[model samples]
Target chain A: MDYRARFLVDPLKKLSLADIDPDDTGDIDKEKAAELTATYLQRMEEDQFLLYADGRQSLLVVLQALDAAGKDGVIRHVFSAMNPQGTRVHGFKQPTPLESAHDFLWRAHAHVPAAGEVVIFNRSHYEDVLVVRVHDLVPREVWSQRYEKINAFEHLLAENGTRILKFFLHISPEEQLERFKKRLDDPRRHWKISESDYSERKFWPQYIEAYEEALVKTSTLTAPWYVIPANHKWFRNLAISQIISETLDEMGLELPPTRVNIDEIKAHYHAAVKATENKKSD
Target chain B: MDYRARFLVDPLKKLSLADIDPDDTGDIDKEKAAELTATYLQRMEEDQFLLYADGRQSLLVVLQALDAAGKDGVIRHVFSAMNPQGTRVHGFKQPTPLESAHDFLWRAHAHVPAAGEVVIFNRSHYEDVLVVRVHDLVPREVWSQRYEKINAFEHLLAENGTRILKFFLHISPEEQLERFKKRLDDPRRHWKISESDYSERKFWPQYIEAYEEALVKTSTLTAPWYVIPANHKWFRNLAISQIISETLDEMGLELPPTRVNIDEIKAHYHAAVKATENKKSD
Candidate 1:
């Protein structure tokens, strides 16, 4: 099945968390998924090189998930393969006091990918809709109207040559509890488990409702959301990598055209090289 | 010779451009330099990973150079090997009108690397002293006082956990001319060769004088300058890579400690994973 077609949140239709299976891997075995992921990663690296050389388009990957939904793993395993020079990752934690002074999107806007760059946001302005709504951190009238605001912001990015991919890592509640337990099992991973994970699980249904509205409202043709089945970690990585690779490939990036007269420059360069060699030998 | 020790600007001693040989490679052939550079780059990647994991210290590399002195090349070749998740590059171009309204350091301060990241400045606040002085864009009285302001600004960053490495890519006038000619001769590189290249060559003596004063006045214990001999591109890459690798290695980074009870968490996690498996099988 075409993951983009299967996974993309159709803007015209309403989205529901129950319609997608978190554990689904489209019948592929673990090994095949891994092999496919590697292939997509290699293609991603080549596409990114052309993107950087072309110095025009930008890519922004927004990963949104409940705690323990593999946002960090997806970043480390998938996006790390690209050149560090052209890729950046910004993790939006709870907003600091200074950040809160401005509108929620202010901080996010500052780190949007520049031309010829790829930026990954571990969590992004969407938090204003998700967490802020779930916890009643902001008033309803304000949070209620953010759907259009976010769509407008993303439309602005799209108009300015940025390709955005938002992934709602759809993990089952049972899987999240299982993962949280694993963090407890491994001493080194304990830092990742928090009190909020257990407390937040109580609001799972509300969280899902919030996400459904977000995915349905903001998933436009230009900046789409992919509802990845993220219970199987390897499969999640595979699906996300495949979608990104295809998107970048479709960009049809080419090395920017040379602006100077090549023959004249080549002759001058050769003569300069010869002159340097003579000076060295002398 | 220790490249750090060899290239470090002595704080007490006045620097003279005539005293340093831009073409010197410290007796190493191009092949040996390349091998050494690769070794340092590998070490740099490992150290940067630890730094990111530790999430403690940040490193800010400030690259200052005359036009065609290889600032872009140095950033592309030397710093691209690290994880993009933990690295950022900000090129300070001619200030936009908004940026020009602020004090020179304001724009630079906004982009300093956060804890556990490395940021490279393609050109930095030092330009306020170098170019602003050489061109007399600002009065001598105004630009003259900026050296102290820069030192104070860097002192504040050092106190706040940023380790700074500033490199003045020291190239001879002849080499700058040669590089500009090469850019003119290569169609792909023509965008780099500008009218400024020819016009700026006229200020070679003034730029050197500006640089010598900036180095002598601002080189401090926390944020020192390295005057790199940049005519030999291979040697330049090798030296800068070695210094950065060694500096990060000396930081003694360790993975952050777990914040929760490991033994308790582990038992809970095991039970959860087992419950998940049973649910799947059922």
Candidate 2:
């Protein structure tokens, strides 16, 4: 199924998180969701080798989500399936003093996927516009300018061999609270809990507004943003794996052609084998 | 089944590649080698997650193999099974002008695994000792000093959370010739052939000597070398995967402990849930 159209936040299209159901699984049968996801994951494995072998184009996957919205889950289940030789995942946390000192995209630019590589940004440069705007971490004028800057930065990457994909995991406030309660109820998940969970819960509306504007402004043909309905984890995985597999298909990846003359090498091989045989007979 | 002792180049012990038969499959039944390899590969997946969650240690695997000795084969069969998010592979080829200007290890240092990462060096700094010496790319004094330089550099990495494992894919000349013949015969694999394929074969003895010395000098308690009998590809995969699995076992990998108090989060969760429920009733 072509889930790209279902989830894609099309360029210049207005985004309303409220309009999409958090539990939406589209028309796909729920029972087949897991099976479809496995098929896609397997496809990604083969596609990754092709990408590595071609050694020309690159991929940059940007994942943005609110707390408990399944960013980590998607990565653990989907992105992890890629051969590590060619895939890289970088999570952008609170800017260190060093990062805070630079322009927002400075650190991110350092980690963009090289040729034949796929780099994943977990909570990427979009944070400058989303979280910065939500929390007023920067002056209004300073943060507002970032939307255009992000578009320009992504455009620059696109001009290079990078095919950029951004996904915003969309879940409701109710769904988030349910997830938090489960985390609170489980002792093993305590490490994931932090002082900010409840405090951030208060900023739910603010985050949604920030996300809406960022999505509307930055989603482009070159670097499309998809709003994934992630209250259903199985559906989320299937949709993401499918989209990435599709992108790899679109990349036109093929192994590079022979760099040397095959006939010449074959002659050399025959001569070498004959000499070894003659020496053995002696 | 403990293949570590069978292949390990014991520290400070004199080394000789001729003594170890490259065709040797050791005592394991051939059919069982493939089955056992799958088990270890599956174990590595779980171990990889634990290592990532622990977020404390890293593993750097250096693969130095002669051409046609199955470096790519082992990587595809073994390392690719791990999650791409935490694992990385770097292949060192002939130095570009920029790389040539710097010290030999300069380019390699840039790609070492970070905390909780597993990095594979397809060809590595050992090239300084092997190729540089064999080709007289550098003077004797320059190449002679590198064994200890390599040791000191690896020791530094080991001191700072990196566990190093080096594998020398041991294959006989006959095996290499057979591999070359297969490549010559297959059009699909022609892309893998290079002009140096035949030119490099003449250096087989020199490379063996280079490898023997480098293996003896650098294999340490911290950074060990394993001589994998790679004439049989299945046995090679089995041995390399088994050694890596055992190393992970020794690392005592575990999920990090919860960072916050569960009771405090639970109280917040209840209050939040009550607020939502009361609003719904209103």
Candidate 3:
């Protein structure tokens, strides 16, 4: 069987990173790829600054993917270039004892991006619906209604100047198994490959179906889900950068005005230098 | 008067970064200084990983300093070396309309370090009492009681497995004015130097008194405030690093053990690689 055919996940298999062709395009020219990647990252950074200056607008980037689907890598390489002053990242994990006491959305809502800030959620509030629905952790009645609840929640955020971007990183089951194996072999990566991740892998087909339905039903113009092809890391990064840059480009922002008090600066500089010179003469 | 004394903030002045020292110790022997700085950073990273492995204890670092007190530089260079997976940073600025509508602690509570995470607050909840009080933005009754309220808020965080480290970067007032003048002269930095900063500088003495009062009242054992010498950049980083490393070292943590089903892994790897190889061969 062909690699793409064997690994590719559709609605039947659901979409998984493990099924896609990792080397789908053979190879591209390294220099051209690097230039393209650099340009994309640079544009993202420039637009981020504009969004920051606008102060009236807030951005929430939700990244959801199967294990080893390159979510961490994308955040590190692409968003790392942004000024820390303007950007914040929140990684959602299992609920803590304290967090469990509150509604699932309470803890997540606290981390929402404020005006003029870019907030990235590594997982996010959708877990209440996705994981809960897939594992049967919550009743069908409870988890099913979360779709409408999520849409409403996002709508509210949109009404209040928060632009939401959701990315479902698509990979195949076969691709995921390989990545999982690599994590086991590599000691440096062992910490990241948890036992729970393996247990979760058993429900791959279920997750895919849940994700597809969620994407179609919940994706709105205000908070749209961009189904990104995660088989290629370079392409995934570029796509994210392009989306972010396009969003910020739409928000008109210019560099803050410059202030000049040159005369005062030169006086201080010369005074300090002369003081040092006098000390040397002494 | 010396630069440091002239720039030392009074009780009335608003805190800005105009006077912070940025040099990484030029006078010290180059190799020795580098080794010391590198050692400090390395130790901090090691301790951070250990604390993360513990998975229960968290840390909150509150940075309070006058203008040009190396807050941003310290964040960039010092914390930059730590593992991103275990650290998060929040830079607090002026309160937004939403933030202002809520309690003073509302915004800060949202960014508390999660279990196994080290969260840095560039500015913090103290702003409501300090800046607002200094500028008379809030009434005497409302802002004055905040000292006790601030202490109570931090006390709660400490009780909940958070080790709070509050730093007051101490630089002389003269040094501040010199740095402010430099910002005005340099076009790249001109945007950062604002008229409000100049206006606040006029009340430097007033701000000092407010800080002294805060330090005396709020410095609890669970959440102590460290007043570091900020005139020397190298010294400040070294001091902060030492404090952070010591805190993490107290928390015992082992590198997470790698577990793999050797036979299962071997079988999976052979099958996957062979499948890929056959396709390539074809």
Query: Quick one: best lDDT, which candidate?
Result: 2
User: Residue A61 deviation, candidate 3, in Å?
Assistant: 1.1
Using Cα atoms, each model's DockQ against the true complex is 0.29, 0.63, 0.19
Name the lDDT value of residue A190 in candidate 2: 68
Give candidate 3's error at residue B171 in angstroms: 3.0
Deviation in Å, model 1, residue B171 alpha carbon: 3.8
lDDT, residue A47, model 2: 89
Locate the minimum summed-lDDT window of 10 residues in model 3 chain A: A1-10
lDDT of 1: 0.86
lDDT tens digits, residues A159-228, model 2? 9889999999988888999998888777656666788988899898899999998998888899998999
The model with the greatest TM-score is 2
lDDT of 3 by residue, A1-282 (tens): 122222222333344344444445334454665676688678877777677765678889998988888888777777766766667778898889998899778888898999888888999988888897898888998888888888888999989999998887776666776677777777666655555666677677788778877776677778877676667777667667767777777766565665535565456556655654686699
* Candidate 2 residue lDDT tens string, B1-282: 688999999877788899999988888888998889889999998888788878899999999999989988887789877876788888898999999999998999999998889999999999999999999999999999998999999999999999999999999888899999988888767777789889999999999999998898899999999999999999999999999999998998877888776777778888998989998999
Q: Which parts of model 3 are misplaced by more than 4 Å? A: A1-22, A25-43, A94-110, A137-156, A186-195, A218-221, A231-235, A255-282, B1-47, B80-86, B90-111, B125-161, B182-195, B209-251, B256-282
What is the alpha-carbon lDDT for the whole of candidate 3? 0.72
Clash pairs, candidate 2, are none
- Model 2 interface CAPRI class: medium
The native-contact fraction of candidate 3 is: 0.19
The runs of at least 3 residues in candidate 1 whose Cα sits more than 4 Å from the true structure, single-residue gaps closed, are: A13-57, A81-87, A98-103, A114-117, A138-144, A171-193, A197-206, A230-238, A252-282, B26-39, B49-56, B172-182, B232-234, B274-282
Residue runs of model 2 more than 4 Å from their true location after superposition: A279-282
The model with the greatest DockQ is: 2
iRMS of each prediction in angstroms? Answer: 4.1, 2.3, 4.8
